[model samples]
Target: MEAREKRLIFPFSAIVGQEKAKLALLCVAVNPLIGGVLLKGDKGTGKSTLVRALANVLPEIEVVADCSFNCNPMNPLEMCDSCYERYERGESLPIAKRRMRVVDLPLSVTIDRLVGTIDVERFLREGKKALQPGILAEANRGVLYIDEVNLLDDYIADSLLDAAAMGWNTIEREGISFRHPARFILVGSMNPEEGDLRPQILDRFGLCVEVSAPMNPEERIEIVKRVEEFHEDPISFYKKFESEEKKLTEKIVKAKELLPKVEISDDLLKLLAETVINLGIKTNRAEITTIKTAKAIGALNGRRRVSLEDLEKAMELALPHRLRDKPFQKPPQMKPPKPKDDKEHNHDHKHDHKHEHKKEEKSGSARNQGIGSLEQNFRSIEAKIPRIESKNFDGSEFTGYRSSRDVSITVVNFPKGIPVSYVPSKGEIRDVDFYNSAICAVLNDKKPPIKLEMKDIRVRVRKAKAPTLWVLLLDSSGSMAVKRRISIAKGIAEKLVESGYIKKSKMALIVAKGNQAEIFVSPTKNYWEVLEKIESVPTGGRTPLSSALYNLLLLANRERMKDKSVKVRAFLITDGKASVPLFGKRIKDEIIELAKALRKKGIELNIYDTNGKGINPGISYVPILKDIANAKVCKI
Candidate 1:
């Protein structure tokens, strides 16, 4: 048993660095109610190693002996059908204790595999309905570790997140219905350079940790030695940390018992909210996670009350991912007015009010300053990661881009939207679908008892409408490079990529510079693909507005040819600096003619003015393009 365990798992205390990440994992172990954690780092940062090692340090849990869902014996109210039925029978259910395991979810996991599916073979053979439990069932009361989580399919990712958040996997397929407990600590590790997580999925994680290679030479040497030792003699390395792992397990056991008694005072709650608000976080999940994590830390230290230090640690783990910090924005200040009471007794009241107001004003101002300082620190850490600023596109573009169409198709079917139809062969079967299929079977049955057969089986046919195509006509000319205009354009393009992910839309990037117009990326629905192309875009070319407009016309024509019903919108990002022309004609005349022709193609153009004062000596030509294209105008 000892040798088997050592072979199966890595020792937690054996990990050399990533103290913060280790602490964050321990905090969640103490209190799974703190939600789950996301680890963002580069490759070879020990993110996955730490998570795998965590299972060894976590104490065993008591679950129903025969339950595949790992149903908690103590929580009868939340048990699965089998366990609940056993409980209802007034039978003493056998309990088994096992070590908490780390269940790995690979990048290629499918939705049906993450969530359970119907047992079609058994149902067809003996008319016995059963659920084939999946990863969620196996992960209950343990850790669900998703490696390379950013690369996971978007639909599968969405489904896993939904189950993780709800703590239950509901399955209704082919007349087999089941709802099993899916409560588990979700640990997702990803290299941010590969891709970015959607905001919705990112927010679902309770804590976000950033890990990197140890900078200190001593620490780096220690990591290398430990890794080498582990690889050379796994059993010896495991034994070396066995005592430490046992102590950690004991600590976690105690922390779990103490977590409920751990109190978060109003002061801590106020601090959590103030910290999140000051950091420009709009969601309340971060605030709740912060307080819960602080309490968990307090519990780990055998304390009854959370401390300011705990709050600080919690902020460090929870704020970085949620912060929408604008480095240029000034820290907010509290403004207080002098009290104006006239009565003799009111003078004392006024003085007290003034004192309280002054105190609050100072505290609020200090918190804001602290928030700014914290953001600066975060910026220093993320300096290597280029951040995309939020879209500042003018009102009309915002409205036009946000207006999503409602049309259904049989293409992409994410785990969202309403279920509309039931086909003979696809999608998960809901309870209603089962009854519908059962009714259809009964109505056609010649025998009495109304037995259903495999031919009677029906599944849901879900449909999702394809989103609009946003064509970005970016000006990568020399004029855009002046005064960081190119940087701003890149930032805007990145924002569009994010928007495309949220809106479920496709984005096409067209860059015109250096005497030519080229397609950086054609219409693509994948955010990672768009981001990769956006990063490779070259800057430093003469503005060629006429050539760019012609390309847009060609693109619009091609998209229409592919699908006439597909909606296409174009955003022209430029400084109105058109110098080159098509066929050696006058530049202005060529642009005007092309712009008129582009408008005729039914492609909506939103022109963003990328000009700063004195950056371009040419007179503003945006008016001409706007007139010819009848486009919406916006100033960057």
Candidate 2:
């Protein structure tokens, strides 16, 4: 056996602050069955550093010497097929001991590369199954680290989470099946400012910890000093913490050994269930993960029985992200204003009519003063805003986050698209599918380099992903002030921008407030800018719906002229109130004409109706706008 090269790594014990993150990592190391941990926070918080340092503190494992899947030597059930077969035949498997590895999964990894691909040439030549192991294989019984996990492609992220939960990776492509154990401690670190994972994927993580840079001056200085020392003499700095690392490693080993023996009382189990229920977390994984984490904590503390403290610590790490708030609940109904009595009205008219007029002015002044209070409570109304979705997707490049199919055979001309499959060629083949060709030859019992027929050619089919542009037209008129409509519109806009970010799309904001509509944000890929701009948009003006639509059409046209294939979609958030006219025509006529013009230009439109019960019930022009513009409408 050859010796492995050693790399300099900061000691785990040397890390300061983030005590909760360190404990979460240790718990997972002690018991991988607790699932995995998600470390979410800002960058430069030592997330990646902690994960890499974790390797030195983990105990070594014994595996078959020549196995690619890191198959355990003594456990046949956990071994790869070949190793199990050899063991079943009374053959002694070679055993080797090595430290558990931390495998880094790159952001650009593809499905075939992640789950392993079959060796087509080998299969055709040898007439046997030969599996090419992937990252999952190497990570078995170890750790898989994914940095910037929130930015990972949704499909790839889903595959990883599924493999983590299932504890196995099964490859069944081209009528061949192979399986390998992929049980590993999945550690994913991400910055929340970049984006967020889907809720379902987020809940799959067994525990989560939020990390941030230390605010204390002393801790900050200490961190800076230690980093400088490490940079000055890496080996010397490592030596300083060698004893502490050794002690921690031994503690982890002991915890793993004690994990099985650690038991929790029935009272603790009931309490755990009650806590999850109280948190409004519906997933059973929450309860199961809490129990497992508590047991691991007890074991790590050298205790045989779980205590309340263990459970408390476990819940802190396990249930924060899983805590769900009731969303989109109907607000409390407002009471109607009382009508004045006829007798009191007549008496006031005779004597105190002037006083009544003064009082009425005072009441109107008070109502006008309350607008600032409504604006202050914008955040409170955000939870009640429902997620918006397009009623129809035109298969345009910007229509969805996933890749859209291009039916043109010219896909081979574009090298950027991923080649997914092969089909029989209809004409001269520009790109050949050699793998499928080899399979075709083998199925026909033909030898290698023995084919010379046109029918044997296969064309590669590719799937390409194109970026999308979301043009948001926000209605910031005074009418939106009623029922906190402007706040809800802002919330919906933020959500849309978030989706745009995930889809790798550009977002632009158009505010229809004041005398006329104006483009607040030009089309750009920086969704953070869009979100920030939405927060400060003030409301108190006429709905210049016509002007907003006109500006949108011009923007869409400009984008189209720049790139012929650019997918542009418009989202108009209004209560169908076109109070301000762009041209000399009536408000209704001008907006309808603009809507028709927009439709004729082939730009997609989606309307978000911010209409609700309020004192000023503006005329809803959504039906006319929707009919004329062929737009999809979502009522908030």
Candidate 3:
């Protein structure tokens, strides 16, 4: 909470390039009627910068002053219990409306935290009245920004899609509750090359824009100049845009007021629908978004008449993710081919064979009636096409027929989803063109194999044995609560256990505190129990780094004797700030001794040191921990 933090970002016009991306976002702002938009691009592409700059121009929100979940009092019907209580008590609840806010959804966030969990303190100490309001509740009627959308752990993304589409936030467990006004514009940004989102989620995005680095030279120069100017004097540069910023704010207000009048004529609507269908998009929602966004663009341009240009702008935003895309996205290319589908493709392929047979079956009288095909006279003509190399094995050269393209037709047919881009309409033609028709007609076709030979071979490589997991040594000292390290520790443990591992590997947890170490959950297949124990551990006590090492030795020794066993590595989850060096021994030597014992037992010790700020400061008692086991740090 710095004083200088609450300030306007650079004006949208001030952004150097990425005009399409900028326009797309602004249209949404003008008419939130357009649902949401995704800014797709790579790192350092100014996606985040452009998004932050949005705060300056987005319309403000009116909220109830004393409402914890910030329910809008003006919409009395939407107020929850707490807000309703104050409303009925006849107390004058102040209303402080503020500019719409952008809430950031960070990765590594736990389900309980992202979606509200019961207030344990109230449930335990006061025996009821659990508190609510997770990130969803707070994001009511605003924007929820998700960075690195592709890499978000799957479960969290599921919840996000649910809340966004349903527009109602509900937590079914612990109690039956409802929060109706939980709708928000979900702005997801990602580098598509990293990975792909589930198709189900991808279809939910109302609009999508692919953002790229500047390709135009003049634009590139402007980018450098604006970025440098902002860097040199961020505050002043922002200040200079204040007037332009205010002007945009006014424009947004005006646009919102003017939005309703914008119309989509039936003719234009049909065009929009045709465009969507031609693009191969799946849902009706895309059409709706395109219409709303087109109108928003018209409103922004100060025109009540929605033009084709406006529709084009909106269509670009709505189709990328929705459309199956060019190059036969429909079945032959659209859906991934299935096993049972091979016959379907073969059925189409057989027409080519049948036409060739018909040509051969012609009566001698028909052949003599001045209607001879060039196929019977191939040797008379000479054509030099690039000779395709043969694909059959040296020993099996006579085994299968090699097609003109050098593809071998084996006894086994290829399965579906494989496209035949070059099939012909006439005469057993595997490929044909108006110009190539005469040429292909002169080529010889191979006679069908009198007796086709076939065989089936299958190899089953057994799945690799599971890697063994060790214990997680967590610091439960009082200071952990102050730094919120305990929460992080528990969260990591949950993730590690949840990190699906094969049956061979096992996980355990050890809580070290006040001169003794206790095993919360033992090494076993029961991961749920381990997770439960981890979440239940209370943080407080002296750090007992020594005892935790001793118990780990016992388990490490037991695991070492097993064949191909992944040595259980203990993740020493600590702040790297331990107290009073264990048992009057030099801390370094103590760490080494523990590590040495582990190594002797064929186990490795790993210390996940969080340097106060979830940043991994490399192995603290390094070379020592290195001796017993490999040590690495992870920050989230």
Candidate lDDT values, in order: 0.72, 0.74, 0.60
Worst 10 residues of 2 by lDDT: 328-337
Instruction: Using TM-score, give the best candidate's number.
Output: 2
User: Which candidate, 2 or 3, would have the higher TM-score against the true structure?
Assistant: 2
Better model by lDDT: candidate 1 vs candidate 2? 2
lDDT of 3 at 338: 22
Ranking by TM-score: 2, 1, 3
lDDT of 1: 0.72
Compose the digit string of candidate 3's lDDT tens values, residues 1-636: 321553435556688778888787778777665777788887888888878777777777778876656678787666666677778998676888877777888876645556676664344344453555688877776777888776665557777788777766666534535454566777778875454455566666677778889888999899898778878887887777778877887888887788889886664675566545544456788788888888888888887878766777777777556654311121111121122223322323343454344335433322223212222121111121012111122323121211233112211111211112222343232211222222233233312211111111111112222346558788887666665566655555554454422122367788887767787776665554565577668888776676778778766666555734354667777765455466789766777777777776656565654444445433445445644565544432
Say which prediction, candidate 1 or candidate 3, comes out ahead on lDDT. 1
Query: In candidate 3, which residue pairs get closer than 3 Å at backbone N, Cα or C atoms, i.e. clash?
Result: 329-334, 595-628
**Predicted candidate 2 versus true structure: per-residue lDDT over 392-423, tens digit per residue:** 23423222223244222225522334577778
Q: Could you give candidate 1's per-residue lDDT for residues 46-112 as a string of tens digits? A: 8888898897888889989888988998888668888998899998988999878789998866556
- Tell me the RMSD of model 3 versus the true structure: 30.1
Model 3 CA deviation exceeding 4 Å by range:
1-3, 6-11, 76-78, 81-94, 120-127, 172-180, 325-636
Task: Provide the TM-score for each candidate, comma-separated.
Answer: 0.69, 0.73, 0.51
Cα distance off (Å), candidate 3, residue 286: 1.9
RMSD of 1: 9.3
